[model samples]
Structure formats: structure tokens, C-alpha cells
Target: MPELNGILVHPDCRHFRGDIPCRPNKENGYLCADCPVYAPVQERILLIKLGAIGDVIRTTPLLRRLRREYPAAKITWLTLTPAILPADAVDEILKLDLASTLHLQAREFDLLFNLDKDKEACALHDTIRAKQKFGYTLHPEYGVAWPGNDLANHKFLTGVFDQLSLQNQKPYPQEIFELCGYEFQGEEYVFDTHQDKGYSWNALPIGKPRVGLNTGCGDRWTTRLWSDEKWISLIEQLQQAGYAPVLLGGAAEDERNLRLNAATGATYLGHFPLEQFINLLYQMDVIVTQVTMAMHISIALQKPTVLMNNIFNAYEFDLYGRGQIVQPDRQCVCFYRGTCKLGTSCMEDLPADKVFRAVQASVNA
Candidate 1:
């Protein structure tokens, strides 16, 4: 890491304007570390974290921590196109569209944090050229080494993140407590961006302690998913039991979402903007999702959540939090495959009544 005026500027860092030549002199354009701007960067921070909805939800706590870490900075988030719709945590949401954004000039940002490990995402961080960059080192051992689909991969990532916090002198649980500085607001957050795939503003939360649900299935991947029929059955039970259901997912998941909505007479705000989805989730009492991101979002929301995971491959830390987990009665038979040899008999083993009881217990509790 090369230092300029106390700022660590890795020579690999890309910050200068292509044709506009400016000397790398510390006096004129000093580095991030030594500059007066670093501490104030939380106010003008840029974050690029894109993946499943749960991942985005999980990252919200980082924003809270960052704000507490740097109280005076503005936070501008770079969000995936439609995902940018309703993010209440972000001060401003920038679309990742290269065509439109390429014409826009880069501005001076105090820090850039890339939560996702996508190369394209890394490139975006390189472009912003924030005074500071925080992310997985892109190291081979940066996370768990996975030869096959396994829950340990998620566990490994959690461990890697913990180690990263320690390496940075930032502890884990305390960091979480510090970031979750604000008390949980009962209001549901909503979307601001209106791109096609983006969520609509009309999508709002209903009921106090509102709960969000991601009841979708997985086919291409080995990650577990509860059957739609099971989730629908649970939803109907909740409806008769006086609970309003809120379904969230991308537009592609809307068909499944509609199926759930039609069956239960609950609210089906089709895949709104990503921001909107999260904002709406904030108002939920809890979120119950398949093994994917449901529980992840709940953790971020500081609300209780329940996720159904394949017992063998669940992320340990996530399962430890305000989220409760239910798993297959048996070890994963199919593991990671195009299809399960047992026709996913292992997952089918979780009777809906047991899940319904769990839901009732959660809702009442």
C-alpha cells in the first residue's frame, strides 16, 4: 500500500481522471488516510453489495455501524438496478448501469465498502477510488474452500468475516451491537427508485410487527427450499389465525409469489425495487424464508426470523441469531445436485403442521 499524505493508496488503486493529469503530490490531492476526510466518510460513503435480497438485508447493519464509526459522513449506496427501489438505509441509490453511469464523472468519496465478492463489483470499487476500501481480500482462503455445496461454506464465510473484523481490530458481537445503535423502528421502509425491475412505492407493509416471507424453491442449486404448498398452507393458517402475509422476491419470483398470495388472500407486492423490499421488511415482525435469505434479512432487520435449511449445510452464525431454523429430519441425501435421488424426501420430511406450530409459536411470542 503506497502512502500519500498519510493515505494508503495501493498503486493498484484507480482514482485519477484518465485524461485530466494531476500530480500524485500529497500537497494537492493527498491520500485517504492522512486526509481530513476519512473520518467524515461515513456521511459520504459508497457501498456496493449486491446478491440475494437476504444478503442486502444482512448488510444493513454495516451501514448502521459505519454511521456510528463515522458520524458525519453521507452514505451513497450503489445498488443493483431494480434492487435500488426502496432502500431506506441508503442516502442515495446509484444504479449499476454502466452505460448511464459511465458518462457520469466519479466524485471524491471518503470510503468504499464492497460486501459482495463479485469481480465486477470489485471493479466498481476500484473505479470509485474511495479513500478506503474494505472487503474480503479476494484471497483464496478468504472464505471456506468448497469443493462441493455445503453449509460449511456459509459457516466459513462467517468465520472469515469474524477474522477480518479481528484483523481490523474490530470485534464481532460488539461491532454488531455498536452498529445496531438505533432502536428498532416499527415503521416499514419503502422503495424510492422506480426502475422496471425495481419495486413500486405502493408496496407497503401491513400490521404491526409485520413479517416478510420468501417462500420460493431452489432447483439449480443445492440450497434447500420448502415446498410452495407447505408455505401456502402455513400462510392460510396464519390468515385464519389473523395474520397478514407479505411476500418479497424478484419479478421472476412473482409467479410463485402470486401463487402464495392467491392461496392465502394475503398481500402480494410483487418484486418491488430491492430497496423497497428491504424497507418494507423493516416493518415486519419477523421474516420466515427458505434456506436462502429470509433469515438473513430478519437478522439485518433486527427482527426474529425462521429459515428452513438443509441441516448439513446451514450457516451457523445466522442460525444463532434472532432467527430460528428448521432443517430436514435427515442428512442431505441429494446434497448439491440437479435433482435429488430421493426426490428431496429429506426436505419433505418436515411436516407442515410442525412448521405451522413453529410459526404460531413465533407469531404469538
Candidate 2:
């Protein structure tokens, strides 16, 4: 306990901040001694999961279990995409940068979890001061990333070897929960929908079920892309089926979306910023997308989703009983390869009719 102006300060309180007056004091004008909302943090836990936005979103299920197991713990999460994390769930959401690294190195945590296998994340895990550490860390002797504990061996193995990844049936949430020594019970993703921002899309037609078509699979994985022709076909089919098909993507898919809109006359609202993009996705009754950020967002929003898969394992995703995973009829020769080795992508085998049926099923369900 620290003395502030001769009054004992509850530094262990989750809302206590040394730099400024805590929220309770500012809002209610109550001293720490008489605060009703005071919550003493029993443990300090650090979670390092810096990566692609989808991975960050999917990792949120662990927070549910962590809260259940350690209700009085103050959780700090370090990530590159801090904006995507639910603000209410995490006590501290620090963007992974030089300043964050320095802050983390200085602070001591009761428990630390480094979920990313990236060298930078592992290296930080190795140097960070923590009483106990779980998940992956940079090996002190070999200068390579390795599991910090035995429980992370399955996740570590699946990450490094494509063969093991293909054979593994454990979903991502289960794997991460096991790494932290907990059983996964179908925890839902914690997401910030940005509904507070008050974004609206008047251009979207009413009276029909809005079907969002997320067209891009990102440049890294060209093998995951469905052909423009396929998208056009799907859009036409959706419109004919009395569904209002909406084109969805960022700047990367703008041109394709424009082409689809011109060809099929589907609703093509131009791409907006990330926050607004999330809000736009929220309007959809059901979303049809590749295994990208939109897919994870749809899952988080609890929207009926139809996920298209080609390269990654279908079993890795836990849709929380709200969606279905549709894969190519032909087996993907490239398990995790960005470029297809088979001259043409196997996504061709997954017909537009199959995807339309999936969308129809998801909407009807």
C-alpha cells in the first residue's frame, strides 16, 4: 500500500492508477478507503498474442476460462491489433511495440502466457519477468522457439509440422486452453462490434436476408481465393433466390467487388475503415467468407456463417454451432501453401451452387 497525501492507497485495486486519479475517485469522488467499487487484484497475468487479427480474435476464448479460474486477476494483453480486442474483458491492452516491450520487461507478472510462435514474441517471453510461464518461448541454448511447458507440445508440434496439423482434430480454442492447463467448453469469442459508433448503411436493401460475400482471402494465401467467375455466379444465384447479396472486403477486394457489382448488380458498398467495416458486417443476416478476418468477425458476432476452406484444416475452427465449414470436393494438395502446386487452385472444385446451398442453409437455420 502506498500513502497518497497521508491516505493509504490501494495500489492492488484493478482500477488504481499511479499516474492519475482512478475512475471511481474521478466519477464518484470517493477515496480508496471508502470506495464501493474497489476490486483488489489477487494476481497479475500477462498474455502475449501478437499476430493476424483473426488469430487475436480467436484467442479471446481463453479469457473466459481465465476469468472463471482467476476472477480477481488483472489481465494484461499485448498484441499488434489491440483495437480488435474486447476492451471490457482485458484490463490492459498494449500494442506490441518498443514501448510496450520495455513496459512488459520492467513489470513482473504472476503468470505469463506467450501464445505466438513468432520469434519476436518468443524472445520477449524468454526475457519477461514472470513467476510462472506457459506456452512457447525462445530456447535459451539453441536460440529457437520452443514450448515453455509440456502442455504446449501438441500446439507447438502442429504449428511446425504440416503433417501433424492435418492429422490433429483439436480446435484452436481447445489447444490454447490445454496450453494454459484448462479444458475448453466451447467458449465464445469476445469482440467489440463498434455498435456504439452508430454506423449505418442505408444503401443496403431491406426486406431480404442480407448475405455478405467476403471475396478476398488475402494476398498471402492465393490458394484460398475463389475465382471471380465463381463469385459472380454466387451473387447472381443469391439475387435470384430473393436474398440481398452484399459485397464485402477491404481495399484489396475493392476492384473485384466493383466488377462483381457491375456484373451481377449486387449491393457493393465501398470499403470503409476497420471500425466501420465491423459495423457493416453486423448488418448481415448471414456471411459467406473465406478463412479470413471476416470469418472470425462473423463468428464473434454470432452471425450465421459459411466458411470456405482450401488450405487450412477445417477442424481447427470452432464456429460455436452457428456456422458450417465448406471445403473443395477435391482434396487440397497444398495443406498450408500460399501458392497452389497443382497449376490451378482446388477452390475451383467447390462450386458456386454448393456455396449458395450453404448460405441458404445458414440463413434458414
Candidate 3:
């Protein structure tokens, strides 16, 4: 037989692209360094973030920094929701589908960053075709593991235990940046959407310092929701205090919004799709809500925000000095558990008066 050609030996290898020879790998398997042909690939970057709308939005700040660092690199982002990303920021957008997954596995990339911690995401990071892998990954037996970097390890350690997380002083974005060896310089959120749909405000008189109360905390985190009575009390108090209280929520919150509106005579702005809801959010002078998508939107719009957070790590939020974080007077016993073990939720213990005061400060500022 003719001499075995290393270049064509593993043509189907995930890293086998064009004339580029794979790196020498005797121990791990593919001995690319001994390949006959060698071709260097252009810088290709991959980012996988997946779902949870709020998280997808908060991660946009990384795009700016990444572009700055890799100006000529072709950036490809994989996300479940693509509507929220800036139109001109990314070079390619890949949805979380079979075709996209196959394409990613087959393609060669210089760097890959998987920000999500889900098993699926971690597995993808561990198996993808990239010279370097950053962010979280799955160990075959021990569950999710970081890239063995000090900063990333610290971030991962904090996530595993509540005690460590409570001591975290860096903001969420900064933590991610540091994981990639980049220093955070106060980057803000970027939310560029296709504003094809329009929402009519019904000519409601424009009120200065318009205050919006976001009543829903999403289905997964019921521990963040304030009591119905607390909401009603805050709405009534805001109105009496001379502020326009607009009730905001999705279909899940319709009944609650209706009840609150009827009881307090507050303006109930019916929920629209994500894009339309964001449009309405821009009209508000300030937003009051349990840490949710609404709070993220308010921060994206640079609107003053009064954020109520209890179970989640407070350090995760970076409101850019435009908001105040309100918590229950008592230390949360159910921190990050999503469910409250106590008979009454810590959120319920958060008095309406306290929320009202926070709202007032935000509205006036």
C-alpha cells in the first residue's frame, strides 16, 4: 500500500477542515500534528446562551466586548430566542435545533463559549469542535464543571453554595467577563428588536414620573411574587401619593391585574407580546417589580427601576445606578430555592410600605 496520508486519514474528523492539519494528539486519539497537509483557519467564535429571555438580554453586553477584542472574527451565537439580540451585532444566529447542533459539531472554531449551565448546554460545550472551550461544561460523572480557571472556578463555587454566593461582590456581567480574562468596564445591556408591531396607549394622558408595577414573577419563581394584598396596597398608595400607577403583566397575571385595577383604579396596560411590552416599558418613568424580565427591560431602557429581590443572589443584578434593590426586612431563609419552606413567603413579609417608599424614590429620581 502507498504511504498512509495523515491529512486524509481522518477526513471525517470534526476538526478536519480544508487543508488545515489537526494538532498532534497521540494520547487523546487524532494525531493531527503528523498530518500531511496544514491550513490555518480564520478566527471563528461560537457563543451558546440558549433560553430564559432575561438571561439572553443581560448577556448582550458581552457582544460589545467580544467584538472589540475580535474585530475580524466571525461571531456565531446560538440562542433559543433570537428576537432580542441586536440586529447588527452578531455575524450569524443559530437556533437550538437539530440542524444547528449538527452544523456546530461539524464545524471548526477557534474559540467557543457556552454561558448556560444546563446539562444540554454543558454537553454541547464539552463535545463541540473548538480549540479552546470557555464557560461551564459537564463532567461525565460529577455533573457541571468549570474550565479550571480561578475566576470561573470562583463563580462556579459561588453558584454551588449559597454562602459563597452571598459573599460575591462583583456584578453578574463582570463575573462572566472575568471568566474570559476580560475586565468589566461597566458595560450596559443591549436590546435591539424588530418593532413591527405597535401598541396604542389609548391616548391615556401622559403623566410625568409614570410608575409601572410589574405583577408577575414568572411561573418558575413564585417565591419572588408579592402578595395580592401587598400589590393592591402599593397601587392605592402610589395613586394617593400622586403617581400614575400602571399595572403590567402577561396573560398569567391578567386576573390579578384586573382585580388590582378595579380595586385601586390604577391604569391596567394589558400585556402585549415581548416586543410590544418592551415598547410600552419605554413610556414609563420608573418600573417596580420583583426581579423579572420587566426589571431587565426597564434597565435596558435606562428607566428608573425599583427591583424587589429576595431568593436570588442580589449580586447578580447590575442596574447601572438607575435602580434600587428592595429586599424583605428579614434575611431570606429560602435563598435561591425557588420555593419557600416557611408557611408564608419571604416576599409576603416584604411590606407594601417599604416597596412604596422604594417606588417613590425611583419615580422622583
**Could you give candidate 1's per-residue lDDT for residues 187-249 as a string of tens digits?**
232323223444444545445444577766445554456677777777777667666677877
Task: Quote each prediction's TM-score.
Answer: 0.56, 0.97, 0.83
Instruction: Please give the CA lDDT of all the candidate structures.
Output: 0.55, 0.92, 0.79
RMSD of each: 10.6, 1.2, 9.2
lDDT tens digits by residue: candidate 3, 134-162: 88888767885555345568678777877
Candidate 3, residue 214: how far the Cα is off, in Å: 0.4
- Span of 10 residues, lowest total lDDT, candidate 3: 1-10
Winner on TM-score (1 vs 2)? 2
Pairs clashing within candidate 3: 20-39, 22-32, 23-33, 24-33
Write the candidate numbers in order of decreasing TM-score.
Answer: 2, 3, 1
Best by TM-score: 2
Residue 305 in model 1: lDDT: 71
Tell me the spans in candidate 1 whose CA falls farther than 4 Å from its real position: 1-44, 82-88, 99-108, 126-128, 136-214, 218-223, 228-287, 292-303, 311-313, 316-323, 333-338
Q: After superposition, how far is residue 262 of candidate 2 from its true place, in Å?
A: 0.8
Ten contiguous residues minimizing lDDT sum, candidate 1: 144-153
Question: How displaced is residue 112 in candidate 1, in Å?
Answer: 2.7
Give candidate 3 misplaced runs (Cα > 4 Å): 1-42, 140-144, 193-198
Residue 72, model 2: lDDT of 97
